[model samples]
Target: MWHDKSVAFRLVRKKDVQETGELEAQARVDRRTKNLTKRLQPGNIAVINHSDIDRVSAEALVECKPRAVLNAAKSTSGRYPNLGPGILETAGIPLIDDLGPEIMDIREGDILHIEDARVYRGDELIAEGTVQTEETIAASQEAARAGMSVQLKAFATNTMEYVEREQDLIFDGVGVPDVKTNFEGRHVLVVVRGYRYKEDLAALRPYIREYKPIMIGVDGGADAILEEGFQLDMIVGDMDSVSDKALTSGAEIIVHAYRDGRAPGRKRVQDLGVEHVVFPVTGTSEDVAMLLADDKGAQLIVAVGTHNTLIEFLDKGRSGMASTFLTRLAIGGKLIDAKGVSQLYRSRISNWQIFFLVVAGCVAIVAALAATATGHALFGLISTWFGDIVHWFATLF
Candidate 1:
């Protein structure tokens, strides 16, 4: 009877196997890829609704080490050469694109399995999409390069419109509110969540330690500064990207209430009971931070993770990239980029500092001499002897 029961259990196990999946893993879904990545674990599938995914976003995903990425929307829509799809492919992570909106319906923590392009829940197929490989991503990027001219033309038009409307703001520094942080004659480092920010910040650690500049983190960049073990002096951005801990980290918060960023930006800060200054600007928060630094007399502004190349703006898909040019023009030569500055100049104990230390020590000797009358008589005698020697030396010459 025990042998018969064992055979029945085996049959039941076999039946369940046919109904279940071979490559089962939990699903982590979010419409916003950035928010999802915060809790995304290794060996878990990431379901996102990102379209034309940019490089920075892709880099964030790769860092999370997800098993597979399922995009509900197209990863590359031939708009421009977006680097996210290729980055995921090169990292050896399975990227299934255009899985349709139904993939988002998969409950969070649901045990899911992926086979080829298809995603399944037990025996039922949930969603299917085109699997991205190296060849497909390369072809898509090549095709996307052709769209750059169109993007450029649009960028120029947007830039021109911005200049016409915000001429007073950029040149006159209008609407840049005063901050509690004293930036006068001090080096200010403004960090943004763009380009190679992680590496740039790593490079600037020496500079940061030596200069002890006022640290201003723009949005997610605030988290970057805290991660580096430095106190964040200021955070300039809409309230969406930064952590609540950063808001309460004693850094003066400046909320960028841009055209559409006004209401939601203010409310989030209010909910968190974070006291903030609302500066309504027309351009990006990074630009606004630079302008504020320039207006408040920052001696040298070192920028990190900012857009320095044309391809970068395109990669981020920002049409208002011309604002970057305008902001630089407004700040003149005082603002310098920190991307390669670390490689160019490593901070060290300089000769000037040593010289100043010696000078400080000499001050005491001078003070001691001035306090005694005998010191004055000795100075006079030494001067007469030195004058006679100078006269004899002149006769010999």
Candidate 2:
């Protein structure tokens, strides 16, 4: 069934052999895009196993400025309309798709040459894959759009199933753990490592400064908070994608564990000698962050970089966003998206503007004084005093 579906949307070639210009670069291979990004240097080929590469991962890859990308998995599985491949292709990064598991056979730091959609090691052809061009990507995207109705139906069905199973989250707010971070009657900013989180955070600088909300970062979102020059009050997640630096950033850590009480990330935090608390829950870390804030009586919950749309949920490749959907329903009027807030909220007055206003006011006062008769008398007295001071200085010299 999978084979038939893949075959239906397979790239149709004009010619069997298209001229792919010879390109030589060192290869950095990893099944995980996040881990690979740290090792990727400019001009090196990034080999990854990410399927339906999400926007955030693609943005991270693009920042490294790699010569090309070689994938062991499909960049777009026609599951949903993911923008990752388009982002890479638009940035002029050649994405070689589904080179098969054999592509992983190439060791790290190996020098490689790409020619005509084939990878070579020292003049020997090691692997071959489909070279994703703009045309092929556009076609795949169009097909994905056409398939959305089907995907949405499946998503809705799954969401309903999960909602039936997890009604406690909506009604009773079960599994919400107590933490030291206070949210009572105060604004709480819950950040997730999703679509344009950085831009959204940048836009919320004024809100963050004025309100001084309790800052909560979920996984890599903690790193995002630190990158924006803010201190995190709490870091909640499975702790997979967050950096060691962020973990040690003195923020209180809350590890999200499975319902069976198995916390895989707890050991890492322990190894780092950092103090942390374990919150066993079934849903995602972002879901837990919102639930935690909401349950603790947060006046308002401002979310940054959270996945709210159907396309984003589909890009995550989940059966359904049941926990997120229910969590939002539970929170109700308390939650506000950062994207909307960032657009609507503006800084009342900047420091520079206030400084200029003060200077302008002073200048106007000086001008007014200079035009008055009393001002002339004052100036004459000031000049006499200045002359006496000058004479005194000369006499001393």
Candidate 3:
């Protein structure tokens, strides 16, 4: 049956996005959902995660750039981000948020139409009006808020698991030899999230002319190292907000734990089938990474994007980064902050030195040219061409 609807167009269902918040907010989504979103290409239809018209503006809605957004979320019409009609009004893409099970009834390739929040086939109206104008936005917001809380709770739950594992590690300890190894043997670039990690890396590049260090990314710092085209040697974090690509990267994984002694990343490691080590303690992943390397006998530790002040720790949403402070104390002698080193070791070539180098180069070139046969001929040719000009100038004088 078909209904008297206007916004009907024919297109194939491209990708099935069960959730939209993950991609938009850069938050964690289920593995299957994550895979689906990554696989979603351009010109594909997307299902809306939530229908909150008021929370998001119409301009923000257009940014999703979908052919048409199917709102699976409940929200009020007055809400800014969820107002489908206003969003589609200028963008020209159809808005279909509140159609009930009728949405499932439509085949993936079947042509459909929408008019005044109603769906139709050809001439028959399939379904009319599903989303409420005022309540949908509030409902969607509540759902999102609830979902975020659950995620946070999950993180907390894993923290407890990390603590138990730390106890075992403390009692058991690593067996065999504890012989330390020199870090100079390996490329060990300490990765930090600094105010100027990019600038520091550029300045320190000269030192890399001789020996490059193995890049170690701490948590989200993995993204920073990847941008530099270097393979991450190791990643230390609690598995929150980091991309899956970073986790599955060839880098060795180390999970940082809370002082309650928990290693929360073990499950993710097992799920991804990656080899990992658990270093449970009260510190950020960056701190644990340094400890692991230093204890293993690294000759030098280079840090980038590291928080060096009490205020820096606070900004990172940490109650206390004391563990980081202490760990640095234990290895400060060999530890070098990449940013600090860059500032101190930057090449200070003076203008006079540059001038001398240029002059020396010119003199060497002239000395060599003066003895060459071709040079003599070239000079003779130049002299003859200039002699006429000089004679003319003398006559004029």
Candidate that scores best on TM-score: 2
Please write out the lDDT profile of model 3 over residues 1-397, one tens digit for every residue. Answer: 2122224343212223121111110111111221223333334444434434321223334554544545443433322222334434446444456655445454444444444455555567766544232233345544454454454454455545544544333223332123223444454667765456666766766666566776778776786677766667778788764567888878777776665556677787889898777665655777667766765657778888787654354334353355456557666677887755556755589889999999999999978878999889988989998998999999998
Off by over 4 Å in 1: 1-22, 340-397
Best by lDDT: 2
Against the true structure, candidate 3 reaches a TM-score of: 0.45
User: Candidate 3: where is the Cα deviation over 4 Å?
Assistant: 1-187, 259-262, 340-376, 379-397
Q: Give each model's clash number.
A: 0, 0, 34
Model 3: lDDT of residue 64: 47
Provide the lowest-lDDT 10-residue window in model 1: 1-10
lDDT of 2 by residue, 1-397 (tens): 0011111122223324333344678899999898899879988999998899888889889999997899988899887889999888778788898889988888998888776578877778888888887778888888888888998788778778767866786567776777787788999999898877888898989999999999999998998899999988999988998999999988999998987899999999999999998988766788888888887889999999887888888766666465787778778999998855555657899999999999999999989999999999998999999999999999997
lDDT of each: 0.83, 0.83, 0.55
What is candidate 3's CA lDDT for residue 83? 33
Instruction: For model 2, name the residue pairs that clash.
Output: none
lDDT of 3 at 363: 94
Error of 2 at 294 (Å): 0.3
Clashes of 2: 0
lDDT preference between candidates 2 and 3, better one: 2
